[model samples]
Target chain A: MKNLLTSRWFGLFIPLIAIGFGFFAGALIMLISGNNPVTGYVALVEGVFGDLYYFGETLQQMIPLIFSGIAVAFAFRTGLLNIGVEGQLIVGWFAAVIVGISIEAPLMIHLPLAILGGAIAGALWGFVPGLLKARLQVHEVIVTIMMNYIAMHVANALIRAYFQESGQRTAFIHDSASLASEFLAEITNFSRLHWGFFLAVLACVLMWFLLWKTKLGFELRSVGHNRQASAYAGMNVNTNIIMSMSISGGFAGVGGAMLGLGTFEYAEILSSFTDYGFDGIAVALLGASNAIGIFFSSFLFGGLQQGANNMQGQANVAPELADIIIALIIFFVASSYLIRWIYSRLQSKKEGK
Target chain B: MADILQILYTIVPAALIASTPLLLTALGGLFSERSGVVNIGLEGLMVMGAFSGIVGTLFFESIGFGFASPWMGMLAAIILGAVFSLFHAVASITLKADQIVSGVALNFLALGLSVFIVREVFDRGQTDAISARLFRIDVPFLSEIPVIGPMFFSRIYATTFLAFIVVAIVWYVIFKTPFGLRLRSVGEHPMAADTMGIKVTRMRYIGVMLSGALGGLGGAIFAITTAGNFSAGTIVGQGFMALAALIFGKWHPVGAMGAAVFFGFAQALSISAQQIPGLAEIPQVYMLILPYVLTILALAGFVGKAEPPKALNQTD
Candidate 1:
């Protein structure tokens, strides 16, 4: 009976309860705000799957989330808390946009070139903190936090300087570098669906293979478990740390590339940060810092956001309610000790503690 | 040299005003960390405080509180911030949840809940601009002194003085009192403290609650003084800056105050750079990002080493 508590299946049950509590708490919030939770929830469902267009929009949103989730999950697996994914993602977007606009080339070359540009830019951003953490013994958290503001200011300045010749945003990417798909858009009732979805899914598989089936991944996990132990075992912990951060940053960079080459197709001045990177933290946590888990969790969060837009438009509920719901979900998960204790009591009543 | 001196004199008031919130929040962080509980949710607490500060002020003014509305609003923020911090405290202390994760959740909750409530109340995503702000005071006898007096003391916000006093009180409490000693002991070695009959959990809770109250007060000061309104962008990264200040100061109340003032001065330099002779030639981006860059440098052992409590983030 005690074995049941530690079973892998029980692990799954905790997240489920956390999710259930999140919705329940969200409903309670709605009730207090003088809104009908039933109507709000129904609206939320409709917003996500009521039609192909909503579904496409949800998928579109999920693409970047998936990449960012991978980025965050990768770093987490290496025992690194990357709060700077947002900053890395921004620079990635900027790099991709710059590559897309400059240097004409074949579609095959231009698109890959732009994507690689973004990936490299993001890697550089992540590498700095990783390097600091490795060499100077500075905490990555503080460096990354500092890095976020620097990225924001630097990105904005670059955009403004780039468009000094009279334009609100950068010119739309060249066709060769574009990710928009007319066929998919039409099938989804003119939604902003793009080919980035395939890449996001592909990245998940790649991450899974790399982490579970590769030597480097093992070393990274080892370092994460205990740096001193890994070093004693002859592992190059410093190299592993730097490598994990760069790869994680590559994933985030690709996510940003989707925004540039897929969604907006032009670079605008980023006065404030987009929520995708920050949301990456939540998705990584809710997903248990695994590829498959991140895939599903990001999808869930993306749906919540889409449904939130619908709830706001249809039921007059604030869209920020989705954020509240996500926050509550994280809270429940964080307080899993309480849930586990209650579970123990219930089980004890049935048979044993 | 004369231009440097002039720049310093001109920027003092603005620097002090800006430092008030950071000083208050960092001191709160010191208390919480000293009790062995890492409070990363300080940012979120500040956000909620900022939101409540604005909303409470508006509500009080609507009820004809006149000049007293902002103060009452500050009271509301303090209460709300402390209550909101209970979520973090429970998860970190009693529930033994991951402190950083709980802190992250608290941040999201604060921002989401605050914006959601604002939208519901004002039919917008932000609050109405506050009307009755606490105006600056020219110190009575102190302002009459010469250049030093006018530069350092005149036209300062009352909260600036209050923050310094709070720092002194916190220092005394942490270094000079029995309760303070127990709290530090609990943070450093909970097992030993437990054997000593100290209520480790209770001390942690009190420490966290104190953080929430002071953090809330800091957020309120930020909104009431500089912003004059509350919005999503109003408190951006200031809480993180406060956290950095706490670390930069090596977890000491007076040290935190000094570090916060340094950050504040950097921020003031950003805004006042055009008036400073040679500094005007520097790019705006450089000025804007100076504080963050300096924080990175400080943490990299450029400033000094900062050691946290021994038992911080230990769930067991």
Candidate 2:
């Protein structure tokens, strides 16, 4: 039991150590720029948890990240590199926002329908890479990246032609039919956290079940572990590969919808989809592609993202330094051996006693 | 007859200038991949070098004829670019992290860091335009030839000729030299190379550093020739195009040069395609996106997996 605890705890330590190293390096950078690192850090901490509103904003910022993280994490389990999550999320967000605005239905149907529309749209985007990978043996990395540009241009062009406003955003959704009611907003101070947090959690649970408990999960894992052996064992390698990406894309798309409908309400034309897709990759790595790990990692990432503004406002540091920290975390997680070495050394010391 | 001469003159130089960066970076990737490292961070390194070169030249301007400053700036760009790539090397080579993920992280880091520093330190979203740009050099005696002379000798930047020279040097170093054989051995079979006294780690380090140098040179050329300034989006997807060129060239030096020229021709035509008589009616956006679309087609197996170096995808 003790060994298991130590072993299990080390998984979490990797991200923690990465965070430490990133901060240490950031401090060095701050010193070079002639700023006090301590004050910068304090500002960051306070910015995320300074007040009730700040805390709520943190949760709001975390909503899409959590969902996208789960999406990427789910694909990671199946050995699929779903780099197109960004594209899928944008398509999903477009569908969700369009449905949210166009519908006049009651709250329940409108909300669920919007979410479903977004998920289905994202799944379709995901399906292209899956099909190419499965049928033509194309690398998903290249296809997903190309899909990102395609999704961006297509979305931008459609928004301009069909949905342009004085600003680059769509018309606001009807108040009565919004995902969150005014009464709820009054209580929560209009935080974007609405019910999407629960949806993200539910998606995580769903992914866990789909990856572990089902016969399909077994086939997918087998294929991921060794495709040739799985093929020899008569499993449908191509189908499972496509299906994994499809489901992964579906989850990411819904994550996008959660962002647009639950928080921003209007689909604004962005130069690029907020880096949710890329952030999702980082989140999945930090989570070790496990459901609970994903949950905690999402919060850590979400908090850092939420705190970036505070870091900027007070510390005289650029908000982008937060990205540097995030990159460092992902870098360390990828090189997890550094953490393992520390863990083994620590464990031996504890055992020697 | 005048119009025919004008068309040929315009087309040839445009092809050479447009392909210069592609040729340099593709050759860079050839060096890295042939020695067993899948370097997808070429784009990020290029951006870093672009920014560094612009800044270097900006500060060093007022030197004679804009010559010493830009050359020094190019050197500075190469050094900074190589230093930037250490992040990738450490993460992938030392940490045994997933190379693709590390590469992606480098891209993000480069984008955010460059933008942030430029915004905060420079008080603007981008660097100042460089004053000292590379000058077009004409070969003294060679400019007299009737057809090919003007195309090759006149109105060419010094770096374009340097790129051609580098290609020859890279090809020689890879195929005809002892160091090249050892590097190739490490990439082909690290375990065997390790037993035979070739240092796998050191070889890979050299490969990555060389990639950084070439990527920087490619980026510096971009700043001098086309952009003439370091700004956001100055190098949008040029690095990825170089990656596509490398793969299309089947991971060979001369082949990559050919592929780079081909891509460059396509890119040049895409821009000029809108200017031509029959093609003017087409949308400009489509022209801008043609290279990316073509890259997807290429990646989709216009060139099959003619097997990358055996150790290229493997980690030590």
Candidate 3:
């Protein structure tokens, strides 16, 4: 039992079962709604795998999910709950667009700069909450919630003030700042695949490498495990908290850049949230907060996002069904204590047998 | 002088009306937090309440209970909201999941489920605006006061008065009653409370359920009085704002009420500022962000370190 508790495969196994339960619940929902669960699921699968175009769209969705998932997971690693990822992503999106619009440089210089610009903006957005939590012992949850609103309104205002185009969005980003690749696009049959895919995969690798292969990561995880113990052990808990938050925000910001430079090519004013940052929470939880786990979980979230649209189109299912499935997955994953308990019961039963 | 008086009348009543929902929801938060559970699912509960409130009203009206439909709807919302909150309770309290994660899941579930039901029933995104909505009533004796009457006492929804009454009742119950003491003790130190023979788990459950009821009432009041309908967007960040109020008020009932009113006043000023001479010059974004910024500042110890109950978020 103890060995199973410590096994890494056990971690992966739990999430797989949670995902299975999520699909099972989704099927029940489909049946209850007078829609055939099989048809609904079939439509969901075909939506993502049917064509190169749909596959490309799923990748486009997955890129942001990956970055945002990292944003949430990185913070979770350092004993911080970054509910402000949406806000950070918003600021990063705008900052990236601002850089893309203003900077006239070579592709080598401009694209990375725009992406960096986004990271900085997101970091700044996250810094305030991190500072408050570190300094005043204020709950980060409330501060992050407030920050999300501040980001939305401030970003909208900035968009309207300086970058108001004829329509709702900013002017198209410069060609040099674009993440689009003609090669990827042509291969995907004119789908919105771009260089953001590479960046997202790199982000996953970066997170894995930074956390598993560094001393700072060790210190951060130590703090997460026990802040008092870490402080007694000569770790600067406050600094670690702030650093984790800023890095998390930077990851989320890159997600914003993916949308601004790769998918949309312009920044639009938002009344509602982008949903990527929020969904990242679901992804992070579903992934068990591991880099590889985040990669796969993001694929699930991303596939659902694109597939649900097709389900709505072809099978007449609401795309919100995707959200419902994700929510159920989180719930199932969250209640793994029950799973563990059930496992224990089964173990006892086998012994009795 | 007359212009100032007129402005006060419009803004103060508007502020009170707006504060009603926050006041009710924050009180609910107060119960849950004071009992050691951080009800981040306040937002989701309100969404469930909002959906049910409108649906209940429509059902009541269809059954020929025309004038009483809104009240019935409010009752229905409270019941449904409390039941919906069981998901959170089971996840956090029973299953011992991460409270924050569970809450976030509930928020997503609420929105998704509500919209799914809407699509199923109306074949559209929003329900029809119910005819029998709650109305503002003039306090016959109080409205006749020279200056303060029109601003504070006149033309308010009955729900607003009920909310204030609820605040007083909650204050009394929390500060005076043995049950409230047990709940607070459980939140403060579950082991200690358990040692003292207090049913910590039971108190926490009651606390969470009460929050759900109040949160549901808040949602129903907003829908039946202000929104007059329900939809996907019905309860957008109000739950979080109410949570802020609960924190800013430092887990005290009256304090939370004051914080809620303060928040509402800021909101009212922002909305009514376009008519005010000097304030109209401020950017809309600044106006919109004002309440949130103030909440952040208050939480940053500017309000002198609003300490939460010690065992908040711990599932004992």
Using all chains and alpha carbons, the TM-scores for the candidates as numbered come to 0.97, 0.89, 0.98
Per-residue lDDT tens digits for candidate 2, residues B181-238, read 9889988998999999998888888888888889988998888778988876887767
Candidate 3 residue A353 C-alpha distance from true site, Å: 3.0
The regions of model 3 sitting more than 4 angstroms off are: none
Worst 10 residues of 1 chain A by lDDT: A161-170
Q: Among these predicted structures, which one has the highest lDDT?
A: 3
Worst 10 residues of 3 chain A by lDDT: A1-10
Q: What is the interface RMSD of each candidate, in Å?
A: 1.2, 1.9, 1.0
Residues B33-97, model 3: lDDT tens digits? 99998888999889988999999999999999999999999999999988888888888888998
* Model 2 CA lDDT for position B302: 63
Q: Encode model 3's per-residue lDDT on A238-270: one tens digit a residue.
A: 999888889899999989999999999999989
Candidate 2 residue spans exceeding 4 A from truth: A1-6, A97-111, A160-195, A266-273, A342-353, B1-15, B62-66, B135-156, B302-306
lDDT of 1 at B113: 91
lDDT score at residue B1, model 2, on the 0-100 scale? 70
Candidate 2 per-residue C-alpha lDDT over A1-353 given as tens digits, one digit per residue, 9 for 90 to 100: 35643576767767778878878877877787777889988988998888666778787777788778877877777788888899899989888888888888877788888899899999998888888789877778767877776777677767777887758988776553356545445655666567777788888788889989999988988888999999999999999988888888999899888877878787877775578998999998888888888888888888888887888878877777788788777787788877777767887898899
- In candidate 1, what are the lDDT values of residues A317-349, reduced to their tens digit? 999999999999998887888899999888889
Error of 1 at B20 (Å): 1.1
Write the number of the candidate with greater TM-score, choosing between 1 and 2: 1
* Candidate closest to the true structure, highest TM-score: 3
